[model samples]
Target chain A: MFSWILLSDKKVHQAVADTVHAVTDSSAHAVAEHGAHGGDENLFTQLLHHIYDSKYLEIPFYHNPDPNKHGFELMQFEKWYGIDFSITKHVFFMWLASAVLILVLSWVARKNLKNRVPKGFGNLVEVFVVFVRDEIVLPNMGKGGLKYLPYLLTNFFFILVMNLLGLIPYGASATGNVSVTAGLAIIAFIMIQLSAIRAQGFGHYLAHLTGGVHWALWPIMIPIEVLGLFTKPFALCIRLFANMTGGHIVILALIGLIFVFKSLAVAPVSVTFALGIYMLELFVAFLQAYIFTMLTSLFMGLGMQMESHGHRH
Target chain B: MKNEENNAAGMIRSVAPYLTLGIQIAAAVVLFLFVGKYADDVLGTKPWLMVAGIVVGFAGGMIHFFREVVALSNKEEHERITKN
Candidate 1:
C-alpha cells in the first residue's frame, strides 16, 4: 500500500510537470503570435486551443522535438463550402471511446452467468447497468420503459466514458463538443417523440400538441407546444456541452496561473487548487452523465405516461 | 462517510430533474426571441415582434411549467399512496 501510494504520488508529480511544460510552451507560442493576432485575442487562445477540436492527435509519452510542432497530424481534407468535413481531434476521441466501449461491453456481454456475478470489470459494468435501470430508467420511465433500456444504458456509458477520457493525459473529451451533445439530444428528442406516439397513438399525439384545449385556442397552443418540444433538447445539448467544457476551461485556467505569474511559488498554490478542481471534476463527470440519462428518461416518461397520468394539459 | 456521499448524491438526483424546468422557461423566451427576430427581418417589423415573443413565450412557458409540476407531483403522490 505504501509503495502504491508513493508510485501514484510520483505519477501525479510527473503528470503535473508534463502539463505545466506543455502549457508554458503553448503560451510561449501564443505570446509570440499575439503581436500578429492582436494581444487580447491570443490571451486565452492557448487555453482554448486545448479545449477546441484540432487536426492533431496528442499522444501521451510521445513528445515532439520541436517546440512549435506537437502531436500526430491527422488527414487534411478540403472544405466543401464553408464547412470542413475532415476528421478532427474530437471525432478521433469519440471513435476511440466507441471502440473501447464496444470491445469491453461485448466481452462483458459474452460472459456466462449462472446464479453468480461475473468478476472484476464485468461486475463494475453490471453495477452501472443496474443503477441506470433501477435508479434512472425505472424510476422515471417505469416498467414500460424496458424497451428503451438498451439505448439509455448505451447513452449513460458513452457519456461516462467520454467524460472520464477527458480527465486523462493527452485525452480530448468528445462530449465537450456542442455538436456531439446536440446530436445526442437530437436522438433523445426523436426517442421522446416516438415514445409518445407509441404510447398515445399518432392521432392522440397530434391532439396532445393542441394541448387538449378548445379548437379556438389551437393556433396559439400549437406553436407554444412545438417550441416546448424543441426547447428541452436544445437545453440538453447546451447543458452537457457547457458543463463538460466549462470544467476543462476552469482546470486549464487554474494551471495557466502558474505560467501567468512566472514564479515557482505560484506553482504550489495553483497545482494544489487545480488538483482539488480535478477531483471535483471527477464528481462532475459522473453527475453530468447521470443527469443526461436521467433527463432523457424523464422526458420520455413525460410523453409515455401522459395517457394515464396527465390531465391533458 | 459512504452514506454521507450517497445522501449528497441523492440530493443531487432529486434536484437534477427540476434543472430542466428553469432551462425550459429560459429557452422558450430565447427560442421565440430568435424566431421573432427572424420574422421581423423577413416581414419588415422591428423590435415589436421580439417584444411580443418574450410575452408570449413567458406565458406559454409558465403554463407548460405548471402543468409539468402538477403532473409530476401527482405521479409522486400516486406512487406513494399505491406503495402504502
Candidate 2:
C-alpha cells in the first residue's frame, strides 16, 4: 500500500496541480467531506471549518482548537420557521464588506469637490461606474436598463467585495455560503421578473407562463416554465457557491497531499502549488462577480426583449 | 456606485455560451425527472415511472441541446461571413 502511494505520488500530484478540476467541480468533495469527516480535527477538517460558516469570527494572530475558546461568538440571533437564525462569521464578514464599501462610497471616495475631474480613489471609482454603464448596462440592457443600473451596480460591487473577503487574512467569504448566494439570487430573480412585468404588463406575464401552448398542455407547460424561470437565478446561486467552494477544496486537497504521503519532501512542492491556486482564486473572485452582473443584465434584457422582438434565437 | 467589471465582462463575453449550454441541456432533463418522480411517488409505480422519466428527460434535453447548438453555429457562421 505504501509502495503504491510512493510510485504514484508524482502522478497524483500532477492531477492535483492541474487545478482546473480543483477550481470547478472537485471543490464539492471538499464540502461533502464536512459531513463525512466528523471524528478528527485534522488539517482538512480545520480548513473546512474556516471556509464554512460558523458562529464566531476567527481572531487575527490566534489559533485555538477548542470550539468554545475560539473567536468572537455572535451566537444565535433568532429562530423563525424552524431555521436557526445565527449571526456567524460569514454574516459579520458580509456586513464588514458592506460597511467598507459604504465608507469608500460615502466619504473616503469624495476627493473631487474643487476639480471637475474625480481624483485618485474617486477617479478609480468613476472608471468602473462608466464601464458598467456604457459597456454592461447599455450593451446588454440598453436605455431601458438605466432604471435598473443602481441595483445592478450594487449587485456587482457587493458581490465583488464579498468574493474578495475570503482572500484577505482572517476574513471569511460570505459569497461561498449557499444561503448568501441564494439571497442574492432571489433579489436578482425579483429584478428579472420586475423587468419582464414592467415591459410586458401583468396579463402578458401570466399568459407567457402558458408558453403560448394550448390550454390542455398548460398544466405541464406552466409548471415547466415557472421552474425554468427559477433555474436562471438558481444557476447563479450554485455557480458562485460552487466556484468559491471549489477554490477552497483545491487548496485543502493540495494541503491534504502532504498528510497523505506522510513525507516532509512533499511540503515545498505542495506549498508552491497551493500558492499558485491562491493567485487563481484572486482572478476567480473578479470573474465570478463579473459573470453574475453580466448574466443578470443579460437576463433582464432578454426579459424585455422577449415581448418587443417576439422571440430570441 | 463604484467601478464594476462590465469592461472585463466584454473581454470574457465568449465564455457565456459555454456556461449556459450545459445548464440548458441538463435543466430540461432535471425538471422533467422531478415531475416524473413526484408522479411515481403518488402512483406507486416507483422504478417504472422513473425509468420512463429518464428516457423522456434525455430525449427532451437532447432536442433542446441540438436546437441551441444549431442556432449558435448559425449565428457564428453569419458573424464570420459578415466580418469578411
Candidate 3:
C-alpha cells in the first residue's frame, strides 16, 4: 500500500510538470511567430522602453495582427535642413505644455482684470506667481530683478506644469528629456550672460573673464572662467533631466518586480512599493521645478551683482 | 529674528552652488582633454599635448572651484556685516 501511494504521487507531479512545459512552449512559439524582435522581453527592458523616449509612438486605437509586436506604426518624418528634425512623443508633449501654459495664463490674466481679489483657479495660480516673484526673484535678483519677473515666472510655471503632467497616466514628461532641459538651460545661460553684459558694458564683461587674476595668469584663468560659464548651464540641464528620469525609472522598476518574479505573490508587494514611489514622484515634480527656477534666478542675480561690483571697484 | 532668518536664507544661497561643483570639475577636465587630444591629432604632438591639456583643464577647474567658494564666503560675510 505504501509503494502504490508513492507511485500515484509521482504520476500527479509529472502531469503538472508536463502541463507547465507544454504551455511555456506554445507561448514561446506564438511570441516567435508574432515577430516581437525582443522575444519574451525581460522585465528590465520592458520597463526601459516604457520610460525612455522611442522613435515611434504606440497607438492604442490601432490593432496589429501580431499582438506581440508594438502598435508603433506612426508616421516618421525625414530630416530637415541637414538636421534630424524628427518629431517624437516628447516634442509633442512639450508643445502641449506650452499650449497649456498660454491658455491657462491667459485665462488667469483675464480673470484678474475683472476681479481685484483672485478666485478659484486664478487664486491658486496667483499664489504661485506671488511666491516666485517674492521668494525666488526678489530675494535673489532684488529690485532690479523685477524686469525678469515675466521670464522667471514663465520658467517656473512651464516647468511645474510639465513635471506635473508627466505624473498623469499615459503622459510623458518633456523635461525628463535631456534635450529639452538643455534647451531651457541654454536660454537661462544666454540670459545670464546678457544681463552681465548689460550691467557691466561689453568691455567690462570681457575684462571680468580674467577673474581678477594678473595678466600673466590670463591663459589659465580665462579658460577656466569660460568653462565655469558653461558648467553652470550644463549642471542645470543634467540636474533636471536626472531628477525627473530617476523618479519614473524607480517607479517603473518597482512595477517591473511583479513580472520579474513571474508569480502572483509578488504583485501585492510590488504594487504597494510602486504606489509609494508614485507619491514621492509627485512631490519631486514640484520640488524639482522650484529648484530649477530658484537656481536660474540665483545665477542671474549672481551675474548682475558681480558685474555691479566690478563697476564699483 | 529677521537677522536670523536672513542668515538662514544666506546659508541656503551660498550652499546651493556646491551641489554641482564635482560635475563642473569633471566636465572642465573632460572638455579640455578632448580638445587637447584633437589638437594633438592635427599637430602630430600626440601624448605631450594631451598631457598638457589634462594639466591645464584640471588647474583651471580647480581655480574656478576655489574662486566660487571664495565668492560665496565673501557674500555671506558681507551679508553678516551689513546685518550687524
Best by lDDT: 1
List each candidate's DockQ score: 0.29, 0.13, 0.50
Higher-scoring candidate on lDDT, 2 or 3: 3
Q: Can you write out model 3's per-residue Cα lDDT over A47-130, one digit (the tens) per residue?
A: 556556655544434445666555454447788888877677788778889999999899999999899998999999999999
Predicted structure 3: clash tally = 0
Judged by DockQ cut-offs, the docking class of candidate 1 is acceptable
lDDT of 3 by residue, B25-49 (tens): 7777888899899999999998988
User: Candidate 1 — which residues are off by over 4 angstroms?
Assistant: A1-19, A22-41, A61-69, A112-115, B1-84
Question: What DockQ does predicted model 2 obtain?
Answer: 0.13
lDDT of 2 by residue, A86-165 (tens): 88888888899999889887763455555678878888777877878887898777788999999988998999999998
- Model 1 agreement with the true structure over A128-210: per-residue lDDT tens digits: 99999987777677799999999999999999889999888778899999999999999999999999999988998987787
Candidate rank order under DockQ: 3, 1, 2
Per-model lDDT: 0.77, 0.73, 0.74
Candidate 3 has an interface RMSD (Å) of: 3.3
- Order the candidates by TM-score, highest first: 3, 1, 2
Please, what are the lDDT tens digits per residue for candidate 2 over residues B1-84? 122335555544544554556765577677778778999999998878877876776665565556557755776686568666
- For model 3 the local lDDT of residue A87 reads 72
Ranked by lDDT, top first: 1, 3, 2
